[model samples]
Target: MRISTFLLVLILLTSCSEKDKHPYTFYYWKTKLALDQEEKKALDKATAPYLYTRFFDINKVNGRFQPVAVITENKSFDTDKQIVPTVFITNQTFLNISKEEIQFLAENIHHLIEKKIKEYHLNAGQEIQIDCDWTAGTRDDYFSFLKQLKKISHKGVSCTLRLHQVKDKALMGIPPVEKVYLMCYSTSSPLENSDKNSILDVNILKSYLSKLEDYPIKKIEVALPIYSWGIVTNHLGKHKLINALSQNDLKNPNFKKVSDHEIEILKDGFYFGNYLNKGFMIKVEEITNDQLRDVITFLDKKIPEFTIIYYQLDAKFVINQNFKLISKFQGDF
Candidate 1:
């Protein structure tokens, strides 16, 4: 009888844990400017009662998340950051990374993190997500890299993938890993007529999402651009990035203008041979705020596994909202 009681209690505990392990959506902060400790705290407070993922603006590495200190160290910036109990996705620009480089890159990442965890004695809470945006053409190499990456990832580390990569892939082969976060940005690119002025068309988005029906939808989190979307290019000539969408053209006077092909560029962003693609730009619409909630609802119906997380709360858009509208849709915040 005592044994039976203990077994029942254990079962109850297990059940409780599973229930608590909810798929969460995070309002992630992405910027090249590192937040000071005080700023981090303020940001944390702003995003409280919801899981917040913070990206340290370190754009130096390939196939790996740049450690928080990479950017902070340069300025002697110190953040006594008790990173909130949430996912922290380090951006690893891996498109240029080659297959042979994968294993070596993963090792460097593993050691850096292992050393940090030991140094800080930090509990990064549940998971660490890696943000990589390699294109479909390089998907196989990416999979190979992750396979090797899993071998090196320290305990409690998982990857955050863009929606396209997760399609036609297996996430579990990476060892000692759990969960995958899905990013749903990059629905369309711009035509060459304008420097940067692409539209996030509803039709384009729906079509892209339709292809990902097989991905593990539950562990998904969409990363939305919170700031006004801007495109920077160099007219494919100068090395420096110029504005793709002109700030002068926005609905606000402060907003710039795009090329004369404004309407066509917004509707379709591709270029023909005569025009040639130079730059494409756009500012994501305010409508997407409500659209996010709607998208989540729609996705939830098709696949019960979606963990809907807002990409960021500290982004300019979130801060600029009218309070009355926010209160009405409490879920957006």
Candidate 2:
């Protein structure tokens, strides 16, 4: 009787301890910061401790790289949640920046970010995340900018990691940051003719993660995709991306269901600001709950403990997810 009682106590303690750990974080990548009803419900359900907000983007304006901050209502949100500002930079923008302009770029960028944080009153969170899909040509400039940015924000710094960067570490040298958030989605190109999912392919994910064990980075987290998109291919076989379009949007009589994903456009006109040809095909790509579960299980074996940030908190995706299961995958259960 005593042995059984002791075992039960141990189990209870373990469960309580797990619950006490920080809840998983989330990323709000939308240009507008307002949260819809569904998004608010999802955020409440997840009970996330950190919210990584995309403050602005760095794009090339004329011949100069400038910071374009996204407009956020900044009116309603949970004040208890910590905010981690994220800055996105176009890879081409770094290529345009001259060697002598690196310091100027870094200083101006940091000032712009600081202004946004002050305006939003997001002073509680100390960590700042940099989101850039850097390439071999821009790696030197990107890394140098990171080193400079670190001097401005003395707090924790984190950058995103793509699968290709993980595979080719020689060409994609590590960024000088405190933390690296491995983006585990977008493993394949949606423009390709393949039937496999572009968002999350288990086999492709395994291939990249197999090399993760050898990755030199120590502090690492993961960002998963919870959203979906449609790839519109014209008669010329050129692909154009359409965001947040659903099956209901394709229910028009002009569209014929070719396959589960592919849709044949019988009539061509202006649709979503694009000139749709008659032979246009729209392929819908998404990650289902079961697929997400499988990914969590796979990662459970490889990385038992780490932070998880959903791609973005969209209403459609958040309204349909099982928050309990997602919390479990984040090691909160």
Candidate 3:
């Protein structure tokens, strides 16, 4: 009897462990649908069930809503992994859009996604994700649009939830979707001149997620930041984001270290195709492996079940870390 009981308990524990394991995924935010050798290797290592590919972005252009940066090349497609076509619509698109316009926009978006899937011969999944940072003013219209989209597309719809949206759901209102992908990065504005890393800050994340456990949305997925950028501040207090810049790139004779994260350009004509003047400040913000682990630990406590989708699959960033380490965070915590 004692041996039987022990075996039963062990079986239950194994079942629970399998249930709690989180699935991993990746987001392809590039305009083209082509993958290099490094990116292909990362995707294979991740073994994600699905890949969220950005189809295009929508914005109001001269009183007309149109799609921009549509995927023009399709050099790669994985038959094993399903593709979730993601559309990014600007919040301003719904600012003053009428009900009739919202309906029309939904139909147009559905048609475009369908056309793309057919044209590219993609192994598209039955779900589509909408990425928008809607405010209170546009909340009602955006929700209505989502409903219209669901009706027209006849597929599972998901949207990206910002940190502020989770904290202020009462004011902003919950989106009309079955699931929401909570974006855990971009805690602060990049244009702001500050010493803190704008990409991912644990304290800032905690402040925004004070009420995460109580958040009504139960089926919540997570997307973490795996990318970084440089905030270039000019002499006149102007700020701009310089992409493809890293801390190692700043370690040069032309630059002087101001702090651990800040650097001053000593003599620069043009670096990385961006002209920099002497005394200009560059703040490098990148997420470390330790920070990623901390974020996973903090989130695991509040949310029981979730799929971790890295913000993007970039060769430049993915090659810097061990594929096994980056893909297996779920089992570690």
Candidate 4:
């Protein structure tokens, strides 16, 4: 009788551990919402339980905050998986807003999000996530807006927590949200020389984790980057932004591969997203499988309860990855 009772208690403990395991969430951040065959196949293979889809971006235009919608024509998002409509707000939008104005802005944005969710026939109330890199100046207004948003939202609210913000929480103040999604990538500066690995530098990220022990928020969801981009620079060595093009695309005669990181433009013309004279440079930045593993291991040791969220669900990033390794960091694995 004593042996049987002990086995039963062990089984119950194991079951509870399994129940508390965090679910993996993918972020679908494309301006268009339609999933291609490749993306759909990747999603099916991923088996992620949730998707954080970017609904729109809030930008300050003509001194007024406006929601620039990312309208979707196709509504083929998987119904089996939970959907969280994510809103990306520019920090500048909250810089000059009053408390009352912030409240009104929150109300309008929430309504627009609901309208989009209804149009897409997507499930609501799992919880909505907000992505914003708020600065010291805009922290109060932004936090106030979050407070107002939570009051109106039936579901809970989540905010993107940057590394700098995490380190300087005392100065920036805690955002009024239920869950905070800590973005672990983009730790290095883009304007720095090509030597700096901005995507996932373990050295830079470790310093920021020490402060998490004192952070009041218990619930944290971590978003790690699986995507890569190219920083384009002109002849004058000024930095420009461009989506990463395939190696084959850069193989054209107009682009001379000076080095693995440096691409010297052979022709003076418009390219990628910026107009360039000859001798322009494009530096490719990416997170490797090893780097991903390192970050995951470091985070697991420091904050084991944090949920794992891949930056995106697109095939371009997911296809080449060893997700089994990435998911292993989660307790569910």
Index of the highest-TM-score prediction: 3
- Residue pairs with backbone overlap in model 2: none
Steric clashes per prediction = 29, 0, 0, 0
Candidate 3, residue 326: lDDT: 48
lDDT of 1 by residue, 34-87 (tens): 445544453444322444444333344534545453311224323333343232
* Top lDDT model: 3
Assess every candidate by TM-score.
Answer: 0.55, 0.89, 0.93, 0.86
Identify the runs in model 1 with alpha carbons over 4 angstroms from their true place: 1-69, 73-100, 115-123, 135-137, 166-178, 190-199, 216-218, 231-287, 313-315, 320-333
Would you list the rank order by TM-score, best first?
A: 3, 2, 4, 1
Lowest summed lDDT over 10 consecutive residues: which window, candidate 1? 324-333
Error of 1 at 280 (Å): 14
C-alpha positional error of residue 227 in candidate 3 after TM-score superposition, expressed in Å: 0.3
> CA lDDT, every prediction?
0.44, 0.78, 0.86, 0.77
lDDT digits (tens) for residues 1-333 of candidate 4: 999999999999987665445446678888777877777766665545677888999999988877786658475655456778899999889888988888888888889888888888886566888899999999988888888898887668889999999899889889988689999888887876657767777778889876676778878878888887777776566786665554545666888887775678888887765777777777777777777767776776666765678888777777666665565644321
Write model 2 residue lDDT over 1-333, tens digit each, in one string: 999999999999988766434246578887776787888777766656778888889888788877786647548754456778889988888876786688887787778778877777775477778889999999999998888788766767789999999889988898888789989899899888788988899789888887676778877787888878889987677888888766667787888999877788899787767788888899888777677667676766665556778877888777777755664644321
lDDT, model 3: 0.86
Q: Candidate 3's residue-wise lDDT over 193-281, tens digit each?
A: 77678898888998899779988879999898889888999999999988767788888888899988789999968977888999999
Looking at model 3, report the run of 10 residues with the lowest lDDT sum. 323-332
Model 2 earns a TM-score of 0.89
